[model samples]
Target: MTDQAPAPAINADRLWSRHMEMARIGPVEETGNCRLALTPEDVEARNLFARWCREAGMELTSDRAANMFARREGRDPARAAVAAGSHLDTQPHGGRFDGVSGVLTALEVIETLKDAGIETDAPLMVVNWTNEEGVRFGPGILGSAWFAGRIDDATLDDIRATDGARFAEEAAASGWRGTATPADLPMEAFFELHIEQGPMLEQAGADIGVVDAVQGLCWLDVAVTGMDAHAGTTPLPARRDALLAAAAMLVGINDMGRASGEDARVSVGRLKTATEGPSTVVGASEFVIDIRHPDQAMIAHLQEECRRVCAEVARRYGCGVEVSQRFAIPPTAFDGGCVAAVEAAAQALQLPYRRMASGALHDAANVAAHAPTSMIFVPCRDGISHNVAEYASREHLAAGANVLLRAMLAKAG
Candidate 1:
């Protein structure tokens, strides 16, 4: 048997510079990024990634949903490819490294492997799953969802961005329309490198995190309708205000999640009131509820509680209530063998590491439905994410990339 080769070290300066350059594309003053999916900024970012991949001499392919893949061919063409990558889209005030790091780090891994003259038994692919942020279209992991067959082309056509641009139009405008479907390529294993997005790794003094599972996410649009009236003329007790009902439901949501346990999280991130006038009581109000828990059954239980509380709040305000599910991604656990591969790689590098659960949903969760998959996390400062202040240190970035390199090598070899 041939002896296994040692993985090459990642260049911290190169990685840091790549991250900074990408950050400049959708630069925001508050250190938050703003590259919405299928926007001009998103186009620029995708072009830049394509340029980098081409310079590395990797074969590039785009799926029908515009998911990008840059491949490094292996000695054997018959084996399923080992893949690593993440998304390029960002939240309204997103940070530089959230999804970007994973894609860039995967590229770095390819470069490092090539430089080391290492050839694997299976081809290596760096993936850029489209709309992983779901910032523009209201659904995260759109590309991965399509890849997993959880979503279809008809549904993709119906999705519209915040600006009312249909997904099909934006996809065509961005020049990413491809014929490759998800079922066309099957992966041997998949890996993603991402920032912890939470404070777990930092608090534990670990450099890398081997993610065990991603919490299940439930998103709902709650609407309350009531009679509009003069704010001053209607007595507080007599007024049937939709906004009041929404407020009550929001408070209840917080209480329920907190009481559920440490793993539970509930957020009313977006809210809208129909009556904008100061003197008019709100006749209708709609808000989005985002709840997550590591346990699917527990999340189901929490959803029922949320529904009951919302109904009661509406009754108290003499309003009609409606709840529509926007998106629901069940709790996903990483493949045990893939987890073992990541742990073994981290141990080989002597990096301080811990096994953790992901609080935020990721493309890996969607892809896991179709293939063996896992993720590695580096610490972000203070565990802050989805904001301009999200950050990961250069040292941690290098360490995480190195771990990714080893893990990819293990799977591909």
Candidate 2:
């Protein structure tokens, strides 16, 4: 590996200014941002990013999923590009920094390189993955999944949002979708810079987080059924309330989650009780379960336990229960080569860092399957994310950007 020039310094002020400007596209009342996938806001955001990439002399290459790849050519055309970035789509009540920070940080790296007139042996790439939040259409990481061929075009196109809009229609209307397929180019290495989105780094007083792995995640849709009856006439002993049975199951799930220790996580984020009347017993109840752990075996064991427990509770209440595993993502360990690049960068930059596993899923996790991949996480205020309150100090963000710049340089060289 050779150095064409000293790693260019990132302009902190310029980077922050760009973030604030992008925030204006999906501006919310007081603070949070909302740019659900393929919405007008999302399209506008993509345009702005593309505009910036053009200004930096990077060419746009996108896929049908609208996964934007901004490339800065290198000296050698045969070598694949070293890539970095995160998705830009935000949650309905997302903060300004969650995924957007990663995108802008990569832009900063490109701008810095442009200013320095430095080029690497292999090309550099910044990607803006689409629909990572899965708020509009799930499961999340759609673009990266397609890029990796983990999900085929037919399945991705067939997906529909809660509002009944097909992903195909939305992608077609966005006008950003391109002719290039995800497999058109090979990625030599990929790195992402993001807010830790958790309290660990802040609490540890670390300057950066070198993510080594991501926890496994499972999503289950549970349904409980029982005969509806008049609440006033149905005595407790005679009642076969679905909601009651579900309540017990939730408690049991929580207990199971705790039984495995703090690393295990389980939550019932959504629940609906159908029989709604002052004197009506709930006949049917449905809810979604989200569970995460580092151990796949433990996750599988917990899944079976959930089914067995729910079935038992339903039997006791004279109800029927069904549990379906809607989605499952096994734990992912980042590539050692990619991880070493990040570590060396942090050490060279004199930024304190911790090697840890990410509790949340990220696009890096999906891309890791195809290329050597790693992540750099800066601290966010109080670990808040996916909300308007999400924040990371500008100083910290700049530090992360420098680390990213150095890491990408290390890989691309």
Candidate 3:
């Protein structure tokens, strides 16, 4: 590796302008975007991205799942491409930089190389994995999951969006879907440049983040049952309120998470009761516990602890409780060589950075199963994401793109 930085560095102004241009297609409140997968807004955004790729002299291809790939030819045509990018689809209330940064910054890298007339030993690619937000569809990261062989073709095709649109039908309508398979476009390495989506780098005053792992996640569905009775007539000592038991379970689960350490995350974002009337005692309550940890073993332990706490809390309230796992994703450790490339890029660029684990799941997690993959994170303002106020400054984004460019070059060479 050379101590000197590459010539024709990423253009901060151009990158920021591209972000603003894409944000216009699905504009929301102020700076937010809402380009749900396969929707009209998303199609427009894809068309725009395709146009930009064509303008840059990159050949664009896509898969049956509607995942987009733009390739820049290299000296060795047979070598697998070094790929980079993230999703283009946004959450219903996502900000401009969440997934957009990954895609645009990748394009910026390719553009910088093209302008400098530099070619590598392996081809370079920019990808836009579909349905990553999964706001309309049932599951997120649908595109990468299919590409990684985790989901079968029939199952992926049959999935219906919340608005009743079939996945296959929508994909066909988007006009970007094709027959390209993972085998057809092999990857030597993949890099995703994304906003931190959390406040860590910003709080630490860092310029870049070298992402090494993604946390595992588990969801437990819990139910508490009790006999309904009149709120006024039921004696406090004789009452078996399911709501009360569930409330106690929530507190216990939170405390368990807190005690587990800083890496542990447990949350009950949704809850429901059978009875709503103030005069009637609730007979049934249901809630989901979201548990997460960087270690798979710790996730299992936390899940079991949550179940035990719910059962004990139910017994204390004279209620019957049931806890079942909804789903779980094992923690993902990125490719070591790719991770080292990112770290080395930071060091070479003289950017203050930290090696960190991603708290939220990303398309990079799925791609890791199929290829040597890692990620670069630019700090967002206040660590906020999935909201209209999500933000990353031009300097930080350009910094991340430079790291991505360097890392991709290292791998491609």
Task: Report the lDDT of model 1 for residue 304.
Answer: 86
Residue lDDT tens for model 3, 68-149? 9999998898999999999899989889988899999999999998888788889999999999987899789999999999
- TM-score of model 1 vs. true structure: 0.86
What local distance difference test score does each model get? 0.89, 0.90, 0.93
Clashing residue pairs in candidate 3, if any? 198-383, 199-383
Please provide, for model 1 over 1-413, each residue's C-alpha lDDT reduced to its tens digit, 9 standing for 90 to 100.
Answer: 02455567987888899999999998887577899888999999999999999898797888778889888888998888899999889988889999999999999998877777778889888999889987788678898988898898899878988889988878888887677777667799999999999898999999999998999989888999998999888899888899988999999889888898888888998999998999999999999999898889988888888898899889988999998888787899899999999999899999999998899889999999989999999999999998888989999999999999888888887
- Which candidate should be chosen as best, given TM-score against the real structure? 3
Candidate no. 2 TM-score: 0.90
Q: Rank the candidates by lDDT, best first.
A: 3, 2, 1
How would you encode candidate 2's per-residue C-alpha lDDT over 1-413 as one tens digit per residue?
A: 45555577899999999888988988776778999999999999999999999999999988878889999999997899999999889999998998999999999999988888788889999999999998989888888888888898889888998789988888888987787875676889999888999999999989899998888989899999998999777799898899999999999989877887878888998999997886889999999989888789978987887888888899999999989999898999899998898999889888899988899999999899888999999999999998898888899999999999999999888
Q: Which residue pairs in model 1 clash with each other?
A: 31-388, 32-388
- The parts of candidate 1 lying over 4 Å away from their true place are 1-4, 30-32, 157-159, 162-166, 220-248, 270-288, 308-327
Q: C-alpha displacement of 91 in model 3, angstroms?
A: 1.4
RMSD of 1: 3.2
| Model 2 segments more than 4 A misplaced | 1-6, 157-173, 225-238, 311-320
Cα error of candidate 2 at position 356, Å:
2.5
